[model samples]
Structure formats: structure tokens, C-alpha cells
Target: MKLALILNVIDPKIGGVMIMGDRGTGKSTTIRAIADLLPKIEVVEDDVFNSHISDYELMGESIKEKIDKGQNINSILIKVPMIDLPLGATEDRVCGTIDIEKALTEGIKTFEPGLLAKANRGILYVDEVNLLDDHLVDILLDSAASGWNTVEREGISIRHPARFVLVGSGNPEEGELRPQLLDRFGMHAEIRTVKQPSLRVQIVEQRSKFDSNPYECLNEFEAEQEKLKRSIIEAQSILSNVSIDYDLRVKISEVCGELDVDGLRGDIVTNRAAKAFAAYNSKDQVEISDIKQVIALCLRHRLRKDPLETIDSGFKVKKVFENIFGSS
Candidate 1:
């Protein structure tokens, strides 16, 4: 819920939450629930790219048809495409290549879209992100940053808007993500296995009940999910009006500078996230408490490593905020 709220505030269009944690911590379960809880997005029919919002890239022939006939464009609400980037996927499969079947049968240079295109305007999930090939990882990072995909290999030179929230999950113990890729994640969270026996038992029982009677279980949670979704929609509506005072902005910059966080992205994302939180709570402006709650998620992964000892990064971040801006 916190991650979703943050995303809605930060970058409702392309912001994403990358979850890092150990296995069996309900990472995938939580992602699926969030996807289910979101309102449906409309898309063009049978377009794997979910290309409906813009018509800039449509084929010349189709564009002419729509222009000449003056046909009313129809939009259909489908489940937001939550595409999973599987491990062991090849570059050809991910960024797409020429259509082998088309070339052999029709003798044409038809460009086939890949997973990235299919994930446009939606969430692209990469489980075991740390294990992804370096080349594939580069492609993902480039697409996420630029919001566009250009494939020049295999006699194809197609460019399409490939904007989407990139969500990745991995156990940090297994492998580490490259610093370049790490910076692309707007918010990061670590989930741990529930230690309390009763809580663990409750989780298992809930899963069993969900599996046994999926429909009934979903029905029971449907009202709660709907209320949550309404909250998100309401938050989005008010996000534009939320104010960030100049004093708070200076404090945000100072804290990031104090922590030695690289670049200005941290400052920008932090300010935007705080305003989003304020809007979520129907406040006219952000408060110090909002910054404190948001700074941990924004700056935790951006801090420079200290060799002397282990650091409680979250606590350290909160402490910095408290010292600079006073506790909320």
C-alpha cells in the first residue's frame, strides 16, 4: 500500500517500485494484488504494445484509413498489461527482431514487437532481476530512462514509445544490481519473512483459503480493494495542487548533499514524492512529516557505501531529516 501510494505521487505515469527481498516473502503476491486493485486501462485491440493513447506510430495505411473514413476510434478497457520478463530471455525475444515467419512466407521486412513493447503504458515486472544478462539489463535501463525503444538490428529500424513502470524483484544476497540500473528505480523496499508464528500461520491460511475458493476470497476483499483504488484516484486528482515550499526544497537538497547522494535525481524524486503524499492525504501542502516518511524510500539505495560498519540506512535517513528539519 505504501509503495502504491508513493508511485501514485511520484510518477503516476512511469514511476515504479522495485522490491528486493528473500524468497517466499510474498513479493509476487503483493505485485499481483496491486495490479488487480488498479483500475483497468484502455488499449487498442490485439496490439501487444498496449498502443492506444497515441496514434503517432500507427502504420501509414491505417492512419490514412482512419483519416479518410473519419471513423470514430474505439477504446476497450482491458486488464493493465503486467508483463513478466522471464529470466533466460534472449535479446531477440526481449527487444524484438525481424519476423522470421513473415520473411520466409511473405518476403517482407516485418518488425515484430517484443516484451518491452507489450509492456508499454503498463507495469513490466522482472523477477530475479539480479540474474538478468548484462546486455538485457542495459536494454531495459535504456528503455526505462528514455521512454522509447529503437531496434536497428535484424534489418529493422522501428521506433515506438515504450514508456512503462519498471518493477524488479530480487534477493540481494543472490546477486547485486549494477549501480547504473539501481539508480533508475524510484523507490525500493525490502521485505522479510514474517517471524511471528501466528502471522506466518495467518499468511499460509489466507493463501490456502484463496486457492481453495478464489472467487469467494476475492469477493471478500473486493470492497477493500475498491476503496483503496478510489483513494489512489482521489490522490491523483489532488496531486497537481499540492505545494512544496522553497524552504522545504532547500532542506531536501541539503539532506541529499549531506548523504553524498549522486546527481540531482534524488532531490527531484524526493520533492515530487513528498508532494504526492501530501496530495494523497488531501493536504494543500507538504509537511515535514511527509518528507521524513518519503526520504527513506527515495534515498536508501542512493547513499554512498561506508566501509567502517553496517548502517541502518533507514534510521540514518530519518535522523538526518529530523536534525535538519525538526521532527514532524
Candidate 2:
């Protein structure tokens, strides 16, 4: 799950990660901790949407207008937004609402930005996402894909930049997202509660240390955090230069085809993920080891459900991968 999250941070275009694990597995804690690993982003000064200074597609309407008018745009570094999407949130809360009264009285559309706006160019995390309304889930996925959110009230329509890495976490026991919806996520990571007694004890000890001396604990990890932050920033800089072999690409697609995965999403994600993984490792060329590492994460949830099959989806993907590309 940590690897998947880091990869998404390196390239939000890899889409977002869906994490499924047992309750009390530190899903939320880990997701929040990743924010610390992220480097600060550049945004237009005083922009509510965290609009980029130069990327027009990522800028809000007001910022775009200012740029068009040859206005001096100021930028500042800020932490990437990490938004928690509550289960009971209404559509208006997730997508900004238009003030109908103002629209009618003043003949102007007054738009109030919502969570999506706040999450632009950052992370939007949904806990127990399977329990969220399907329509809201659709809206989130659509905005994540298109990088824009459109809210129409009466005859007034307002759209804004809504690019964000959409991360969702849930326990399989509660419920599961519809297969179609699950497939839309770029990667899926499954984690389990620690089974080793020593590991469990160490986890408890770590938690106790943090709770008792939060400052000390943070200071202890500060160097490590900065190192990881530097690595992520460097990876992002060289991601486009990372290349995957054509044979590997064909083999990745072949694995997807053999697994009966729907659509070309699995193939595309695997390719992108492999490239990201390579870049993360500071390698310019993708190796079979890289593909082997991320193939299952990218394709596991995309496989067709077979009720009678007892094998794990990830294991099935690896088995197919080994057959096609030979054992790593």
C-alpha cells in the first residue's frame, strides 16, 4: 500500500490507489503519514483551489482570467491538500454549489467551491469508500479522470479544475465496490493484520513512543522523511525519461489478455506503473524485475470474478506473468 501511494504521488496520472485491508490495519494512519513524505507544491498566491502558476489547465477560472489579462501572478509553496471525504457528504458538499439567489438577483453566478476544489492537484481520500453513495463515487472518478468538476444549478453551470489523486480505503468485510467501479482505480493494494507476535509488539511499542513523545518521534524520523521526500521529487523529474521495452509491453498486455481482464486499463496501468517504479528506483530503463513488482498491483482488481476459484487474484496475475515473461 505504501508503494502504491508513493507511485501515485510520483505520477498522479497513474490514477489513484484503492487500498483494502482489515479494520485497525493503520490504513488511515498510513495514508495521512504519506502527506509528510510529499514535497510542497507551487500554487498561485491566495488561490483557494491551489491553482498552478503556469499550468492553465490546472488553474481556476479567476487565475486563468488574470493570466489572460497579463496580470502578474505570484506563487508560493504549500503542502499538497489531503482531503477526507466523509460518507454522509451530499453532492453539493463534494461538488461546489451555485448560489441561486445571487444568480437570480444579481445576474451573476456565485460559486462556492467544495471538497473537490480544495483537493485539486492533491489527494482526496475516502475512508470506507465502498459505503459511499455510488453516484458520489462516480462523480469523484469522473472528476479524477477529466480533471474538472461541473456543477449546474438551474441554468447556471460552473466548472473548475479538480485534478487530484483519488485514494479510497475500505474493509472487505463491510462491502466491496462494484467490480466496474473498482476496475477504474489504477492500482489496488491488499494488506492484512500483522500475524507475527514480535512485529505486533514492535508496532505497539512504536505507537506508544509516538503518543508519549510525538515531538521526539517526529524529530527522530525527520532525516529519513527528508530523504524520502527528496527521492520522490527526483523521481517525478525523471519519470518521463523512464522507458519500458516493447517486448515487455507486449508481454504485459498478453498477461492481461490471458487473465481475461476487461478493457485496456490493466495494460496501460501496468506500463505506467512499471515506468514509475523504474523512475522511483532511479533507473532509466524498465527491467523485468520492475514489471514483476507492479504487475499484480495494477491488474489484480481488474480480473473477472471467478467464484469457484480459490486462488488469489494477485497470485493469478503473477502466475500468468511468469508464464509469459519467464520467471524473474
Q: Among these predicted structures, which one has the highest lDDT? A: 2
Question: Candidate 1: misplaced stretches above 4 Å?
Answer: 1-10, 53-72, 100-109
- Check candidate 2 and list the clashing pairs: none
Worst 10 residues of 2 by lDDT: 32-41
Displacement of the residue 78 alpha carbon in candidate 1, Å: 1.0
Which whole-number lDDT from 0 to 100 does residue 179 have in model 2? 95
lDDT of 2 by residue, 102-148 (tens): 99999987898999999999899999999999999999999998899
lDDT of 1 by residue, 209-241 (tens): 998999999899889878878877777777888
The local distance difference test score of each candidate is 0.76, 0.93
Count of steric clashes across candidates, in order: 0, 0
TM-score of each: 0.88, 0.98
* Candidate 2, superposed: residue stretches over 4 Å from native: none
